[model samples]
Target: MDNSTLVKPFKSINRWHMLGWLLVAQVMVAFIGRSLAPLGVLIGQDLALTKAQIGMLPAALFLGQSIASIPAGFIVDRIGSKRLLLYLSFGLGGAFMLMAISSNYFFVLLMVAIGGVGYGTMHPTSNKGILHWFQQKRGTAMGIKQMGVTLGSALSALLLLPLAAAWGWRMALLAACALLMATGVLAYRFYRDPPSAEPHEPERKISWSYLKESIGAMFRHKPLVLLSIAAMGLSGSQLILNTYIVLFAYEQLGLSLLLAGMLLVISEVSGSFGRVAWGIISDTIFKGQRLIVLVYIAALSIGIALMVTQLPEGISFWAIASVVAVFGFCISGFNGIWMNAATELVPFKQAGIASGFTLMVGSWGVIIGPPLFGYIVDLSGDFNYGWFFLSFVLLFVIVLLLWAKRLANKETQHNKGV
Candidate 1:
């Protein structure tokens, strides 16, 4: 692949405008996924869900993402991101609306899982978009784009909680579904693929042999494999915070539902800012050393998580909020760096597949983390157990990151010697 193809500006479309819609798409999909953060209590009560069952709600959504992610990556690399985003966004929104009509927990779980199929498209499609659009400040651009996830989660709390309070959680989901589909339509109308330096073969063709080679190569890349393992820990920590923070504050701290939910908003809002800050740090201070930043994030996550487990019952609400804010900033703010690192390990043409493959592995954390945390909570009747569990997960990830950094350093030295 020609290196010059990586950064060519489009004449027909403004890259910044395209970035805005990509952010909108990211925010809306995340808005749907994190809806459970605020509405979990109401939904659990209405559906008579057990604690483990509540955790399964988000887990099921990520299950669908795990299932479809690799294939979605191939499709995005083949078909162009705009078309896939349009299709997946509309389909995902419709799947979410199905929950509005059903009161049965299993039925709603099925809908969320089905919607997860669409959620699978988000990272790959948006990643390829950013890769094609910006290169000089790619870290900062990716960070701004990745902020959609936290921003969406924060918005879900801000907008949906009030709507859920006024009407019902189902109504809140319906409103989210409507907005997501509308945004998809606008994205389709406006988003354009960036100009390619490889004019004859801008997009790769999909074939069984091609898929096999890409998959095999991805697994064989030691840095990618190690990073993928670290990604699982990051994903686990992130989902745990998104799934349980509100309830933890409510049940453990004896805060009101509305007030407990605001903790989620505060955490996600801080996470939203952290995404941008981490990106700038990577681009400037770290000079593209993303893995070191991730290592730092994991270490910070362990410290904050351990601290959470040790907090006393009578702690002030503001103090708890401050802790949640830092937790979110560390745990929720890692995707941009992780995704950028994964995509960078592969050819520019295969960036979508690399990201998809990485997320497929990471989605296991999404699938297992929440339910496991909830199960531990249920068994012990203590939210502290869940925090301890996340701390241990991140601790293991820090070890993996150290190993990856060693491998990267060796590879750099070998290249220099050559």
Candidate 2:
């Protein structure tokens, strides 16, 4: 397709409308995938699971993402994001329904793992859609799309906790399944691929060659390799905080479950704002210098995490809440920026594959971090060590980002010389 044909459809449609639907799609998918975090306490109590086991729940969900992300990216690029989104909606609903019916811990893990397949597709598909729809203000667009994740998590914390508190976790999960089904119907009715994003021809024969080529292209890209490493570290720390903060508040800080849930809601709400704010900073204030913004956010996250570890005994609720909000803001802000950075590093056609590979590497952090955090808590009898561990992880991320920045500068100077 010519550039004019590619640009025409976006011109006809209100880009904001496209962004809005994309946000809604992200919210619904995230709600299904992220429900486990809020339900941790109830699931633990009901199933007689240890802290470590509860951690494994999110791990399993991420493990599924890790397994499916790269392949899903290729599929999304070839089949178009709209078709994959429809499939994702159904997959999310089915997984949640299975979770609702499960009576055993193993069965619950199995269900969540299945749900991870849906979670795995989210980043690549959403990023691809946003790149197609918004050429300018891409960072801001990415932030808006990413806000769906925090909003979905916030909504779950606000609604599901109460619902589960009254009706039980199973009922809450069933309700989630129903919502996902509704989202699926809406997506089927409205979602469309950008006119420019014509689906690639269907492969008559699937082969290792295609996979090898796609994966090799990503690995050979220097910025992508560095960014993936940074993503891994940042993602690990984010998961640690998201998965453990509520438990930490309730168990270590002597807060009620309702209050803990409220803290989670506050964190997510702050994160929602931070995502947009950081995007604007990257797009405008930083003049598209995404790596600098990413480094700043990661450093800020490490500072906040360290602060969490140092909270005094008998600290006030507002005091703890403030720290959590800052932590949430900084930690949640970078993903959209990094994703935008990754997309900028590659050709438009390769956006899906690059994002998928980057996210696949990052998913390992999600898979391992939560369980490790929980295990550290199990051993130490507190969240202090867990918070400290995350700080160190962020420190590692900063190092990788700085290295990537230097490499980027070298490339820029070399092109100038040429």
What's the TM-score of each model vs. the native? Answer: 0.83, 0.82
Q: Report the lDDT tens digits of candidate 1 across residue range 304-357.
A: 999888878667889988998999888888888998888876668889778868
Model 1 is weakest, by summed lDDT over 10 consecutive residues, at 3-12
State the lDDT at 71 in candidate 2: 77
lDDT of 2 by residue, 1-418 (tens): 5767766765667778877878898998888788888889898889988888999998998888877777786787778777777888888789879887877889889988988988878878888888877769997898678778888888888888889999999898898888887887787678777766533545456478996898899899887789898898888777777777778888888888888888888888887778778988898989999888999998898888888888875678899999989988888667779888888777798897788788768778877888888888889887898888888888888888888888878887888899
The lDDT values for all models are 0.85, 0.83
- The Cα error of candidate 1 at residue 330, in Å, is 1.2
Error of 2 at 144 (Å): 4.8
The TM-score, computed over Cα atoms with residue i paired to residue i, of candidate 1 is: 0.83
| Per-candidate RMSD, Å | 4.6, 4.5
Which residue pairs in candidate 2 collide?
A: none
Cα deviation at 19, candidate 1, in Å, is 4.4
lDDT of 2: 0.83
